[model samples]
Target chain A: MAKKPELDDFRVPFFDDKGKPAKFSPGEFDPGAKPFSSGTKEGDRERLAVIGALLDGLQERLHAQRVRRVLLVLQGMDTSGKDGTIRAVFREVDPLGLRIVPFKAPTPVEAAHDFLWRVHAQAPAAGELTIFNRSHYEDVLVPAVLGDIDADECARRYRHIREFEALLADSGTTLIKCMLHISKDEQKKRLQARIDDPTKHWKFDVADLDARKLWDKYQNAYQDALAATSTDYAPWYVIPADSKTHRNLMIAELLLRAFEGLKLEFPPAKDSLKGLKIE
Target chain B: MAKKPELDDFRVPFFDDKGKPAKFSPGEFDPGAKPFSSGTKEGDRERLAVIGALLDGLQERLHAQRVRRVLLVLQGMDTSGKDGTIRAVFREVDPLGLRIVPFKAPTPVEAAHDFLWRVHAQAPAAGELTIFNRSHYEDVLVPAVLGDIDADECARRYRHIREFEALLADSGTTLIKCMLHISKDEQKKRLQARIDDPTKHWKFDVADLDARKLWDKYQNAYQDALAATSTDYAPWYVIPADSKTHRNLMIAELLLRAFEGLKLEFPPAKDSLKGLKIE
Candidate 1:
């Protein structure tokens, strides 16, 4: 049996000044530094390929184990590379076991239900994997920033989310939450690029800048959210997202560590499914 | 550019033998003599591995393209390996870009809304991958078999589904629907195994056998569902799933072909991210 990788082994620091946790602001983080590249000095490309191969192996083993579920929740501001990160890290994974859910603005019907109702409906089953581009965090992030709910309601939700996640973990599901951190200047440049490039025009949303205006509010929400909710069972990894390549490499490494610890093994068949006389 | 694999190359004979274009009926077709060992033959194992590699590659490329989304829906009867198939085939995929939504008994909220409401909420974003363990097809299959709704209502859903799928395709989402076909005897034995094995008891549901009693009706529903909905834009693949190894191999091959044809490429990076200019 392979020993579990240390949790610290997968940790990628997003903020340079980590001595003070609460004081770490997104703007204080240098978006231009290639933190991931710094770590990848030892053959990053080869490590990526190896991670790809290991993921392929894990997919097959997970199939035989018949545990068909993993949920990966990614939360970040614009240019955090939610799309880019997913493409770079998971490019090598099988489409069958993998499912990606991107949550947008809630429809009128969604607004009618308890916020978690829509999210629960989409949770992955055992023996499968699910990804949430933006998830129930929106209940906290959006509502907190927009004052959609009172401070007390948001606080109550923080406890509710911790319980919700604990329930999932106790029920044989592994929850990996990630917060992609990018600086405001980098976000502005990325938003500008989307406008300047015709191919990317489809991705630009005028409303994104509206969200940017409330950057401090969003950051406070994230800090409070992570501090209140990050647990031993389901922890949060804050990946620096200024460099797309670095972001991809960091996310991939974290996943590789998680899968390695799953202790997945192939389920032995009653007999090899060979030569069954099927007349 | 690599040549795209033709759809016909991955077609299974069982699909045609059960009377193509006719309503599906359980036990209507025989498990013809084994053409080859159903177990992972040497060639099959290598092919499975290759398929795994291909999926990983496609996932990354698709993520890069950031314009296309893929939805894979797996539907089948009890003990038909919907869960098993997903785990085994997609185990190697990156969890970031993939999402899995398993449609179970509808909640009061879901039941209140149109069936597609919950589904559309979980649809993949551009450059993401989503899987539905059971999908909107249940509106047709479950209702038709249980007489939950009148035949006219079920018939109406068939048309609605075709239009729904067409819309998905037109919106840059590629739809791959699969029905896992398992024999009654095989199902009984598996159910027995679940009962006999303590670790497996959690998976058994007495209600599954209740559905088993009405097997033929479910089959008829599936046939109608497939015939009416399978289209040029979104096609359905009926996989031979009695043998787990064979089922995994077939599903993997089908996906490999779908992705190979996508011609996915990485998006260009912004000049700012291309290389850092250190001060």
Candidate 2:
């Protein structure tokens, strides 16, 4: 029998500090695999809800303590279920404690500054749980895949990204990054469905098809980027996302495990309120 | 028999633009009133859920259109349930479509600028629904109640608020402001509960009791601020909040009504995607 799959099995291998980076291939992962599913769609959803409730309580404790920060970075190809994962995974989490930042194509002002400028401004503060829908990773991925940046420039951006994320981690930010891995055939189906349904046209752009044509190029770019930046402080996980329910379940489980590892608890009771009575 | 309660029944009489401002008194409204309640806590929660689902759909259409903006401002005394309202009312809305900005005491940088300077930066952008939990109103209420700002400066801030809101309204933003009104006795019980429960002590502060002692003064300040700043463009409503259920219900209903009035719908299907087939 095949060995049971673990969350670690999907993590991009750690970058070698001794000048020999580990090899990673996005094509090696099967997007249609259900490694983390609970067997049935209904069972997967039930498990997801259980994890969601756990996450919700943990988030409240995080806010009460007000000493830690969390950043979840989500990067995926078009229609690979990035938005759906957030809406599903965080359905039970308090919106008050959650901040979602979606980064689209850079505005003129944004492009004028260093790539990390806008992302740095959106980093999670103490006691915050922030999710970046699309993030600074785009700065490296888009330009590299489009041939606008040479290998040296792409490598430099990766080094900067690692250094910037280290600064955040040193200041007490826990980061989790995921790449929603999907197959090229699945993309064709999703894009075709959007085209068939007029109501969804507003979400569909012809430009997305142009990107789809460069599917192999994007996959290669992601493989390189993930290999370079998957560090101990900020690791990247490849999620098989052909099954939406399985994708949500895997991500929720991953996040829940990360938060539990933090062992967060409410702050100690205040001495000033020990014997006080409201008048 | 008394007349049926309408959401408008709670709105502060509009501030007259021509010379004479309207007369309004916060003390006149009963903080314990449940005019919008469903007569039972269970029923009220059900109604809130119904409105929540409706608001969720309306919010998606608003995002799809990407042409309009919505801002909800929540203000109240320390324990008036600003956080609770946000958590309960938006439980069903997509976190992607919602942004919650909690304005605590201004930082040194923020305080150095004019009062509205920080607020102007956070106004909702197009295709967004933003909520301000304890908003710019604090700038007016706090200084006035402490006697730090004289009558002239207080009046000037109100005018500035009016003009700022007018600018937002003219630019296609829909604004809804609510003041969660809790009575003194109810606040006493809530504070005592927090004090008695050591686990919740983190959320309590000794300074809250000091503010409670000046309850009447805060009421007067709120009354004056609401009266002077309540214009047709951005009106303020008093939400009876002694019962948490009724408070959530009323605010949800008010927002649903406001959103429905916009008649927001998904943008028309894309012409470029009309008959294209994905290959």
Candidate 3:
């Protein structure tokens, strides 16, 4: 029998200590692969539900302890499943403890400050779980692909991202980042489907299609950003996202492992309240 | 044939044009009433699912039109189901279109500013749906009930809230406020349940019982605040919340009616993109 698949196999290698540019390519992984699925849709969904329940309990314990934080960063292209992944994986968790921040185009105020300023303000506090939909990685990916920043400048931003993540890690936060990977062919189908339906027209803008024209550039930018920023304190995983069920399950499995690794426990019982009665 | 229970019947009478306060009291409503239920738990759930689906579509149109906003404010005493109502009513809506804000005891920085400052910063933008788990109403209820502010001061703060809500309404935002009403006996049972379970201890505070001792005062403060602030643009509804399903269903029904009244439509098709194909 083939060896059981491991999550680390998909992790971008840790950045080299010598400050050399690390090399990796998005094209090396097939988007259609389902390395973590249970071989059937029903089975995959059942597995996801199981993981969701465990996540709910773990999140409760995290909140009860009130001493640790968890941050999950999701980055993907337009047609990838960042929103779907958040809805599916967190369906069972209490909304009180889960904070979802969707970062869009920078406003004038945000653009005035250093790129990390707005992001730092939203860092998860103790006993909270935060999900960043399309995070600061966009800073590196967009400017580089548009030729607004040179290679050295992009590398410098990558280092800043690594250091910022390290700051969060040092402050009792566990960070997990994923780049949802999808094929160009899948992009064509999604865009075509939206265009064929008039109801979906609002989600489309003519300028939105301009990104597909620069697909290869964006992919290469992602490759450089992932290779340079993946570190010991914060790691990036490439999620194969062509199969929606498989994508949800793999991400769910990854998160459950990260949370369980925290070994979260509820705060100890209070001795003074052993026999306390409500008046 | 029996008459239907119009949601408007439970609405706090709109503030009079002369600004005379209404004389209604929270004690007039029964916590165990289910005026909106379909007479069985399963029936109420089915009704809720129907309303949830309609709400999902209305929210999509609200986002597409990008012209109007919806804000739902939920305030209740301990264990009266503010969090539960949000989780249930929004279970089917796309998370992309919804934002949930939970206000806790103000921090030093927040308390430094005027009460409405932090709240104004979170008002819903055009084409969005926002929910406040607890809201500005707390400023009146908690302070007045605790004797931290005199009745006259509480009334003055109520006027400030009315003005602030009018500002939002003038900017094309629709506001719906619900006060979850539960009996003191129900609250006692719920608090006792939390105390009995060690796992739920973190959610309990010794100071919580002190508030229970002042339940009648809180009820009176709620009565005064609701009568003073309810208006044509922003109305307050009393929700009988002892039955969780009934509370969820009734709120879902009320929200659907408010959303449908807006008559939202998707933006017109762009003639420039008529039949354009992506490269």
Candidate 4:
């Protein structure tokens, strides 16, 4: 029998690591694949809840320690389930510790600065688990596909991103970036469902169709950006997002592992607080 | 059957409203009373869920219209369930629309300004449903209980609060203030439970007990403040909060009625995009 696939199997290979250069293509992995799934839907949901409980414990420890920080960057096409994933994965986690930063289109003031400027300002501080719903990657992906930035400029921006992320990593932030991979067919179904349900129409904007028209270019832009920036310091994972449950479960499992890797423990019972009765 | 209790029955009577002047006492309301309960605990939980669903829809309309704002201010002594109330009441509401702002002890910078300065900055914007876990009421209550402020000064502060709330209401904001009323015995039990559990110690400060000892002073401060500030625009409600389920249900029902009062509706559909298929 074949050994089951591991999470690293889905990781975008490390870029330019010493003597271990690697590569990735957005198309190389199947968005519909459930390699990380717990087989049945119910089983996957149960696994997600277990992971959620574990994440909650880890998050509380993270807050208590008030030292280490975390940044989870999620980038996906419209309807790839960034909001849904957040709502589900964090169902059990205390909202106080989980900060969700959804970066919409830049305002005039934000557009005035270097792309990294606004992104830098929102980076998680100590003892935070911050999720970037769409992030600095938007500065790279949106412009590269729109022909507002050439290949050379895009390469320069990627290098800047690598350095910015490295600064965060060196300063005690553990970064995990996931690209919510979804197929064109999946996008069509999701978009149409939103259109058919007027209540959901609020979540949709007609401009989303404009993005769908440039799907191929955006896909290539994502491929280039992920391949160029996936480093051991800030690894990128291609989360198969065609299935909502699969996407949520995989992300929760990845986060659980990342948190477990932190070896977080509550601050040693405060000696000053020991057996001190409240007056 | 006894006449069904209405939400207004719990409302602190309006202060200084022409010939209809009224009075209120925090002691007059029993914290153990389940005036809004559905009799059985299970029935109360089901009622809470139904109200929660109605709030979710109303919140969606509030967001879609992007015209009106709602602010729910929750205040109580330690262990009065402000955090728990938010969690349960908003369990079904979209997180995007619900913004929970927990105001802690004022910082040096915050303390530098007039009491309402920091609070005014956090007021709900158009199309928002904002919750103040503890609010400007803290300014009046804490100082009055500590005797740092004289009665005349406390009364002045209460007047300032009424004016500030009036500003919010006049600016298209709907205000709902709930004082989660719990008994001193319940407070002792809750505080002791936190002390017994080291994990929850982070949420409890030893100083909290210092305040607990002044419980009567704080209760008197609350009575004075509520009587001075409860207006038609921003009336206060004394919530019997010993039963967590009932407190949640009562708040949910109050908000549902408030939203129902607004008669929020989806913005008319866009005609230009009607029948325009995504290419």
Candidate 5:
């Protein structure tokens, strides 16, 4: 039997694709890596089915245990397959125990309160699985690069988020953050596809290009934020997201490993039910 | 081509295996209708798959329209298949566009504010779909029967809910509310199943029994709530949910009908990308 791999062993292929060592300084890093191919061969469908069955079992165990909630945060650039990864991995799980919260721009009420207020309300209850499509990390990544807020405020939020997640961990929530790292070329292709296909044109936002222009700055912010915040309790997993299949599999594997480590047990049946007549 | 079925022709079934009909007002009603089994055969997986495809198509159309929002409100008794319907119908949807918000007991913050505050915060954005596993109907149903609030308060909330939904409709958000109806015996069987199966024991909440004792009161509350709130803009679809398969298909068909009415047009692509270079 193969030994279980450590969480750190999860490969992030961005640096290798650039043919140079990637640096994480207080400044920008040039974009690297091509789109990762989803290794969906002919038999891949069968494998996914098997994985789906396993997921059902895992979900049951998690619910039965009534343990701490599990929060899976997926962050990525456009077309990074955040949506696709979530659907494929969690497709078989029971909806009762699963919660998906996608954070968009702050509304008037949300803007009035702290940035984390809306997010806090959406956290999962016990024995549930919550997925955040884009999370509080945006306070650091987007605002820092867009100059929407000052650098000092961004730095302050980075510290606040680390503490916020640590508190959730202490309160029985397992936070697993995944950054779907896609390449610039892949993003361009996807954006073009959205424009070319009338059915997909609604997904294309012209404003996203403004962020693309400052992509290097955003990369620096992400690197700084990850380094500052990834803790033993709530670590970041940077998946090679260029390939939708690979990203989905990697996420599923990460989740499987997390649940496996929790050692969840099913609650025993109440004996009183034996007297109840089903007929 | 088959003729379109009349809305009145949709009759849901109920059952009285344990002779529990004596507990409620006397009326000649089919207790063993099992209305959910209409289009699908017994024990067929295709029912769920077909619903899943319809949900996926609806999601795609909803997204392509750039219509930021859609809301699915599910209200049901125990074993009414709220969880099953949501899972089966939305199993294949893009998670980015979907958000499932389950309303439970009020938290400290929720209690501090008005009831609608928390719910309004979770409303879907443009190009998104939001599901309320249980929702603001509690403001009327629980209070009306339990007398936690007076009749005037309940009546006021009924009007408020209608106005709220109307506001959502006017804002271009499609609101779909479903009430899952199940017989008392079916509820008992489902509750018993939760207690009998060790794997499902965790879902057996003691509070559920308290609600079961007030089953008739709840039915009355539901009838009143639906009658008062169902509007042309956001009509209620009271689905027969005794069979999980039937509930899934019916809900999916309703969703398909809703999306089909949108007549979503994809945005035209700009030719400006012709000069963009990918190095």
Candidate 6:
């Protein structure tokens, strides 16, 4: 019999203490796979609602405790459903407790500093849950794909990223990074849909096709970036995201597990307030 | 026949272009009224959900057009339901398109600068919908209640605020500010409930009780501030909030009206992309 798929099966092999991927390649994951999805969309959505409510409660506990923090980083090519996953999975969560930060092309001021400079400024505070819609990974992927950065420079950045994330983990942050993987054919279809619908043009730019033309090179850059940065402190996962429902379900499950692993509970009752009454 | 309730009946009259509330006093509006409610909690929630979905779509158009901004400011005494109102009203809105800024007690750095320094930094950018859970108004209310600022200083600060908000309005931003109003007796019950619940202790601060002890003073501060600064550019509405359901419903109605008044529509189709095909 075929084995039941576990979420860990999709996690990129964590780099060893010496900083090397045990064994991994972005190409090994099938973007079209739905290993974690239930039989139908309706069933998956029902399941998601359950997890979302639990997440909502867990997130409140996180805020109430005010000790630990959570950081969820999502990276994907255009149309790979990063925005959709956030909208669906957090549908039941309190917007007050969740913060979503989207990293766009750096400004002139941002580019003047180290790439991590801007990202570090936006790190989650105590008792906060922050999502990086796109992140510093863009720094490595874009420049490397365009040959704007040399191989040595790319290696240095990977080291910088690993060190930066390690600092976050040591400071009581739990990080979950996901790469929403989609097939080349899926990209072609999604891009065409945006092109055919003129109302979507504001989201579309002629520059997007330039990136699509470099699809293979971009994939290679992602493979290297993921392999180099996946670590025990901040592990990266490849989410087969052709099916939007499956992608939201899988990401929500991963976050739920991370929160549960913290063994969170409400802080002990305040002794001063014991039997006190507001007059 | 009894007069049908109008949303404007709750509005703290807009300050003339010359800067003065036409005829307003926060006390004139009853805190326990349910003028916007459907007469039942379940009905209020259903109405909220309907408006939430509409808000979700309108928010998307706002982002797509990238031409306008929306700012919703929520203020109230402790236990007045600022947090609850946000959770309930924005429940169905796209989390990506919404930003919530909760202003706590100013930090040392913030205190050293003018009160609006931190607030100005957090103003909504174009195509964004931002909510200020507590806002610059806190600057006026807290200090005035504490007697830290006298009448002349208070008047000067209010003028500065009116001018600052006028700048935002002229910059293509729409502002709606609501004071969630609840009765002193209702507050006593809410605070007592928190004191009685051990698990809620983290949310309870002894300082909260101190503020409650000065409830009447704070009300006076809010009254003066609202009457001084309410303007055509940024209007203040007193929301009846003794009923949590009614508070959420009324705020949702006010926001929907502000958005509809903008007459937002999706940006026109791009002629350049006509007949375009992804190769």
lDDT of 3 by residue, A1-279 (tens): 998989998898889868665577878889999998878999999999999989999998998888889999999888898988998888877777788898989999999999999999999999999999999999999999999999889978988998899999999999999999999999888888888778788888989987899999999999999999999889999999999999999999889999999999988776655667766
* lDDT preference between candidates 1 and 2, better one: 2
Q: After superposition, how far is residue B245 of candidate 1 from its true place, in Å?
A: 1.1
Q: List the residue pairs that clash in candidate 3.
A: none
Residue B131 lDDT, candidate 5, scale 0-100: 90
Cα lDDT of model 4 by residue, A1-279, tens digit: 988988888899888945433556889989999987768999999999899889989999998888899999999999999988988898878766777788989999999999999999989988899999899999999989989999889889988999999999999999999999999999988887777766666666787788899999889889899988999989999999999999999999889999999999876554445676554
- Displacement of residue A166 (Cα, Å) in model 2 is 1.3
Candidate 2: tens digits of C-alpha lDDT, residues A202-250: 8988988888888889999999999999999999999999989999999
Every model's Cα RMSD, please? Answer: 9.1, 1.2, 1.4, 2.4, 6.8, 1.3
| DockQ values per model | 0.09, 0.80, 0.55, 0.34, 0.37, 0.77
Worst 10 residues of 3 chain A by lDDT: A270-279
TM-score of 2: 0.98
- The numbered model that scores best in DockQ is 2
Per-prediction TM-score: 0.58, 0.98, 0.97, 0.94, 0.78, 0.98
lDDT of 2 by residue, B1-279 (tens): 989999999999999878756888888899999998767899999988999999999999999998889999999998889999999999999899998999999999999999999999999999899999988999999999999999999999999999999999999999999999999999988889889998898898798787899999999999999999998889999999998999999999989999999999888888899889887
What is candidate 1's lDDT per residue for A190-213, written digit by digit as tens?
776666664453454455567888
Candidate 3: DockQ? Answer: 0.55
Least accurate 10 contiguous residues by lDDT in model 3 chain B: B270-279
Stretches off by above 4 angstroms in model 3 are A19-21
Interface RMSD of each: 10.1, 1.2, 1.7, 2.5, 3.5, 1.2
Candidate 6 CAPRI category: medium
| Local distance difference test values of all predictions, in order | 0.72, 0.93, 0.90, 0.88, 0.70, 0.92
- The per-residue C-alpha lDDT of model 4 at residue A268 equals 56
Name the regions of candidate 1 deviating beyond 4 angstroms.
A1-279, B1-42, B269-279
Ranking by lDDT: 2, 6, 3, 4, 1, 5
Q: What is the DockQ (computed on Cα atoms) for candidate 2?
A: 0.80
In candidate 4, which residue ranges exceed 4 Å CA deviation? A17-21, A270-279, B17-22
User: What would the per-residue lDDT of candidate 6 be over residues B153-269, giving only the tens digit for each residue?
Assistant: 998898899999999999989999999999999998998898888889999877678898898899888888888878878989999989998889999999999999988988887
Ten residues in sequence with the least summed lDDT for candidate 2 chain A? A13-22
